[model samples]
Target chain A: MKVGILGAGQLGRMLAIAGYPLEMSFSFYDTSGSPSVGFGDILVDKGGSGAKLEEFLNKVDVVTYEFEHLPLELTQKIEKLKPLYPSSKSIEVCQNRAKEKALFTELGIPTAEYRVATSAEELAEAAAELGCPVVAKSVTEGYDGKGQAVLRDVADAEQAWSSINHDAVIVESFINFSRELSIIAARSTTGEVAFYPLAENNHHDGILRYSIAPAPKVSTELQQQAESHIKALINDLDHVGILTLELFETPEGLIANEMAPRVHNSGHWSIEGAASSQFENHLRAIAGLPLGNTAANKPTCMINIIAEKGDKEAILKLPYAHLHLYGKEERTGRKLGHVTVQADSYEELVWRVKNVATFLPGSPEFISSIS
Target chain B: MKVGILGAGQLGRMLAIAGYPLEMSFSFYDTSGSPSVGFGDILVDKGGSGAKLEEFLNKVDVVTYEFEHLPLELTQKIEKLKPLYPSSKSIEVCQNRAKEKALFTELGIPTAEYRVATSAEELAEAAAELGCPVVAKSVTEGYDGKGQAVLRDVADAEQAWSSINHDAVIVESFINFSRELSIIAARSTTGEVAFYPLAENNHHDGILRYSIAPAPKVSTELQQQAESHIKALINDLDHVGILTLELFETPEGLIANEMAPRVHNSGHWSIEGAASSQFENHLRAIAGLPLGNTAANKPTCMINIIAEKGDKEAILKLPYAHLHLYGKEERTGRKLGHVTVQADSYEELVWRVKNVATFLPGSPEFISSIS
Candidate 1:
């Protein structure tokens, strides 16, 4: 089977890897050439959207994107020739905060108290209602904690409002959640849901620092709540492909934070640890095939080796961590690479993740390896 | 860094997995798509031999190959573009029986007593040099124990010689060896040598069935012999990339059976069991990067999942055997996948490999309980 991917990136590279067992042929198209699409047949063209798209569609059996920001009009145009999963309409909702939150509410899912802030005055009013220590985010084009701000008091509201150059923003109460968890579920075109283990994620300066599979400390009730919301959303959207729903484990209950409409970086460890990788599962879903097993052989912890002004060799010394380095030439606060470590015990995983970075120049090793 | 591969097959796919670190990019170009090139970026065209090769010349920084049959013309054409590791000269030797044996003799590598036979008269003369029960093989294109026949007596010799359709055949004395073993070693683009642990292999009907890493019967004497021959070969050919030498262990000594000039299937267990996989090491050699550690984490036994006459689900029942299914859609004597199981003890490793076959059906389980 021939499968075509738009935006040839690491995600597409992994999808091709997953397709290896099924003998699925993959070809990729990207504008500037994705750094991570080092594997498979790739074609890079700098033409504008919809240019030569008909020709591209003719060569492939199916079309999918590695990213949500793919030109919807171009994809819609190609839809005439081949199938594009997660429909262009779905990307519209997931790309904007207002649409995503509204859809969540309509689907009867739990979320934080949020209000639309089209102006600075509305932002202040929403902040007053949501309380101090609130989060104000741009309605669109925000990721990796970018285009978001924290309003500690009334003082930061105006600054936060203007800081977002976009037309609209969202203001919500900063829930004092115990921890953060994420669910990565794949919904096939046929409405099949294959959920990987709930992942516990830790962040450093708004960057995903670590993720542990079979998220430790998650209650069965909380897991059920998350799964239910994911299923409802999949059914509501008639979605196809993987959905990464970030959630907050609050004292009140679980609350939705944000959702990525495609493969999430938080679930990268599944490549070696899981029975079938997220990339493979996503391809299976998009290709309309039965999902493979999502079981893990052992506990796996993935630590993002953020290259923050240092050499990579220091942390790569850890023998157990499966190091993945992105072929990014410059490393200035870049996601240069990640490390996945599978161990018999959680304690060993913690030891490896915490201390491995200490070998690097600037990354201060955690004092006691506590969350 | 950028590295180029002449042929894209499973070996190239495995290398891409290993190239996760070092932030390296490997580009593979096969005449046609190969299953191994499924996960990595593949370049294809009939344009490589002419000025169309100009687009690829400066693009790839270094060059290596996934197999010995890298077209001699393409290898020579790309020589001016960048360094081609192991050199095009080695292929001329490894691709032919007379040249391979002569090269082995030149390097003082212990190989079986053999003579080249291009005709019936020559076959009779070579039989005198290597006594009866000799193996007659076509000088080229013989693989996986195919295109070869056993000569038991004088009557069998005439039938076998004419049957080998190739222009010439090499007659090798069949040694009464107890077992087969293989060694995979790496030589950097500059000729630095590193040897992975020796692997003990078992074949069924002349096809590799299973391989156990850190070969159970390892002794100081055998280790020294294996390492010296590999080092000698590397220095003689000024070889680069990986060299996988297959051998037979007999009462007399270790005898070289055949050599694969790239990553071999017998070393697949290294992906999970060794500190660094053979695939990664191959890319490292081609990229001129520092090689990774190749020490075995634990003993691992791997079983080749062949599509025998019956039973498909039997392999899924084996515990701890990491199953890898090559996505090939075919039946009847096709190699579709493999399973590798790691354990603290050889008894456990052996039990897993032997009993894992039972999980697929048409076989009875013989694996013992932990107790």
Candidate 2:
């Protein structure tokens, strides 16, 4: 089968790599002229024009986007021509915080309390009403902590609103959570769903730096709670591929932070940790193949290589470290690659993850359920 | 690193897949006009001329071949310009049975008693001396049960010799063996070696149909014996990549049958069974990186999908079965792909293997140490 990806980034590259063994070929549509996915037939449609998009659509049997923030018109057009997994409605919802929050509310999934604001005065009022230290984020096109600011007090709302610079923003009460976690689940075209165990995540500078799968010390109840919420979202949207819901473990229960309408970084550990990788399962779901096992094979940790790869040889020396470079050049805060470390026990996995982290410059200290 | 593969077959395709995650790019030189490896910078060097060969060599930082039957002159020529792992000497030794047996003898490796014959008269005499029921194989360019014939009586020697139709042949007494096994080992440029567990293989019509890794009931002594033999060969050749030694487990001990200087079919199980796969380790070795852990993650069995894939959906539905298609058209007796099934216990693995085999048309009954 031929698959066309809307964004030719690392996620698309990994999806192609995973799908190749299934005898699936890929053609990547790079909206950004500089495509980092070094292989595959890449069409650079910088202008998102007529001929190139038509050519890409003609080449593929199905369509999926790695990035959710793509132009809605393009995805809708592609959907008209070919089957688009997760659908354009998924994109429309995930790209806007207000719509996403409304979906969570409609599905009875718990999320952070929030109010939409269209002006600085309204933002200040919402922050005052929600209580101080709220996070004000743009209603749309926000990711990786961009288009966001913190309101320590109601007085800081003006600066926060100006920093966000969007006509509308959502002011959410920041929940003081014990930890951050994410659940990745895949839904097939036949509507069969499989959920990977919750992964504990650690972010530095608003970028995911570490993720440990089967999140150490997670109880059956907690995992089920996370799974049920994501399942509701997936079923509600009639999602056809992977859908990720980021959550915060608070005193009350798991509260949804956000959802990504595609394969996520926190699920990257599945490449080595679980029986089947998220990338592979995502492809399998869209291709109408049966979903693979989602159980964790071992205690595994994925350490992101951001900005620079300090020492390739040192990391390679760690026998358990499975280094995956995206074939992207070095740049500040750019995710060049990731290394997955697995062990018989979480104790050993932590030590090995720490060993690998030492070779990645600017890597945050290893953090997870056990550490 | 840029890796140029000598053949664009399934092995080279898998090598490219494994190496891409390590930030390595691939270019494949297909001496045959038809290249099955679906992806990569494929250069069809059917003419074996100077310019195409030079272009291929120039594009790669290192070189390796998936198949050993390539023209030695071409390999040696490429070796002069690029660092070809396992070297031309490895190819020289592997392509000729006489030289391979001689090397085995020099290393004190046990094998079936054999003699070289130049003509039908010599072959008949050798068969008589060895007692009848001997197998005669061409001294060079033989693989997958090709260029061989068996003699049940002394009078059949001329027919067997004529059937082989080679200038020189090796006549050996056919020994009754308990099972066929193979050990895969990788040696790094730094001379560090790591060995994967021995795989118990079952062959049908001279093609490998199934392989069970860490070969069930293998005593520590037996594993060490197999490892030692492979290590000796790797060291003798100063090999810098994967070296596979196929063995016949007899009443006495293991007897060396043959060797391949690149990744072998039996090691395909490592892709999902071992902590590190043979293909990945092979690339790591050739790229001058440290070898990965070669320990089996679980009791695993690999069932080759010969000729035709019966039911892809059925295989995919088997959660533990990792299906790998080579993207080749179905042909009688051709290896199209394989499915790796893993279970926590040997008994469970055997059952799973049998379950997976049922969906593969014409698959031989599953056989292994446990079964």
The predictions' CA RMSDs to the true structure, in order, are 4.9, 1.7
DockQ for all models: 0.30, 0.80
The CAPRI class of candidate 2 is high
Q: Tens digit of lDDT per residue, candidate 1, span A1-371?
A: 68888877667766776676555778888776444566566677666545655566777888887788666577677777788887777788888889999988998888888998988888888888888889988988888888898988876778898887668899888788888899989988777788888898888677887788978777788778999999888778778988889999888888898888888888898876776778877887887766666776668877665665244544444557566765554464566566677778777777766666564443345323544
Q: Pick the candidate with the highest DockQ.
A: 2
Query: What are the lDDT scores of the predictions, listed in order?
Result: 0.74, 0.90
Q: Give one digit per residue, the lDDT tens place, for model 2 in A92-200.
A: 9999999999999998889989999999999999999999989999999999988989999999988988999999999999898999999999999999999999999
- Which candidate number has the best TM-score? 2
